[model samples]
Target: MKEKLSFKKGHRGRTVFLICDVIFLVLLMVCMLIPLMKVLVDSVDPSTYGLRLIPKKVDLAAYKYILSKSSLYQPLWVSVYSTVLATVIGLLLTTLAGYVVIQKEMPGHKLIVGSIMFTMMFSGGMIPTYLTIKQLGLMNRVITCVLPVSLSAYNIILMKSFFEGIPGTLYEAAELDGATPMSIFARIVLPLSKPALASIGLFIAVGMWNNYMNFILYITDADKKNFQVKVRELILSDGLSGTNIGISEDMLKNAMVIIVVMPFLIIYPFLQKYFVKGVTVGAVKG
Candidate 1:
């Protein structure tokens, strides 16, 4: 009778927690939806309508204009190229570093992990970072945007924690089978840690896609600038001057925002399952 009552209470508590979670999710969705809907409406409507919650009319003129303009295409490509390169490089390096740090017998492992973690809590200021980039001959180059901030200390820690959670007996078994560390990592660890890798990869991809400060500070060439930097320049130059530029400022702003965000929207949905699973596993283990 006591066990039955305990089980019933536990079940009831879970039900209540689930209900609360659903309510919170619904409210969060509504909050996010409002701004997204506003941007969509503004992108399609004529800007002269002015601060409208609902669009007066729907049209694709803003998108059409932006695409047709040659000036926008190069920056868009630059941003895409930079983001892809950075994400790939970041994922590889972070995974390797994480794996190394999780090895209990690895020499200087603690010191290495400590140094990496220390960087997470602190960083050199922008001026110093820029100077270092200049000293390294990365300034005014496309590689500069991708290389400087490729591997984040936080992502490495998360990945290391995920790796550490794997049973040590598995590694011992692999060794008994004459498996080297590389083989064990590739065959056993990599397959088991897909969720964690996917989550970290998505995080790195988003950071790369949204990055603008690096481009602004390191890239001086207008043609070398990424989409975000280009959009800012366009907004400042035309919006502040009150020059029509054959398109309404608001429409341009809305269109640029949509362009920047649309890729994330498309990619994130497909990766949502992996991201959730990986994050949950990592959290539980860490």
Candidate 2:
């Protein structure tokens, strides 16, 4: 009778837990979706009133007005090119650093890895960084944006942990077949690490795509500034001051927000599978 009673209590507890879980998930969905719905509704609508679930009338003038501007095209292209270049270079450097740091037999491995970790907690101030960039003749160059932020200590550590999870036997087999460390990394390790690479690459790409500070500090040329910088200028200043567009300021802001976010929305679905796996795999061992 006691055992039966205990089982009944346990089952009741599980039922309560499941209900709470469902409630929490529902609340989370509502929180995220409501704001997104508001943004979507406001983007095309001219309503300056408080948030609404749906706009009474839909208008495409805001989008049309922004798209008509020829100046936006250059910044869009600059953002795309810079993001792609930075993501590629960051992955290469991160993978190399990760692989080297995980080799137990390598001299000074601990010290090297430790130094990389130390950077996660600290960095030189903005003035010093700017001076260094200036001294290197990187000022006002697009490459400055790519090179300065390429190395991430967190990415290297996550990658190192992922490398450590690989069996030592695989490295031994490759070595016996006269494979150099580089060959093993390129042919074997890289192929196996697609998930991690995709995850880190996505993060780097998104960061580079949204980056405004880099342009503000390093890039002086208006022609070289990326989309975010342009968007920021539009947000801070009166909307289309010199341009003869008649769109409302709120409408333009909402439209620009959607325009800026749309690319990431389209791209993320394709990479979602790799992303989930990558986040978990690197985290599991490290």
Q: Cα RMSDs of all predictions?
A: 2.6, 2.2
Worst 10 residues of 1 by lDDT: 239-248
Local accuracy by lDDT, each model: 0.84, 0.87
Q: Write the per-residue lDDT of candidate 1 for residues 9-111, one digit (tens) a residue.
A: 9999999999999999999998898888788888888753544567777877787777777888899999899888988898889888888988868888789
- Number of the top-ranking candidate, with lDDT as the measure: 2
Q: lDDT per residue, candidate 2, 44-128, as tens digits? A: 7776479798888998888888898898999999999999999999999999999999887899978998899889899998999
Scored by lDDT, model 2 comes in at: 0.87
For candidate 2, the per-residue lDDT at 32 reads 92
How far out, in Å, is residue 183 in model 1? Answer: 1.9
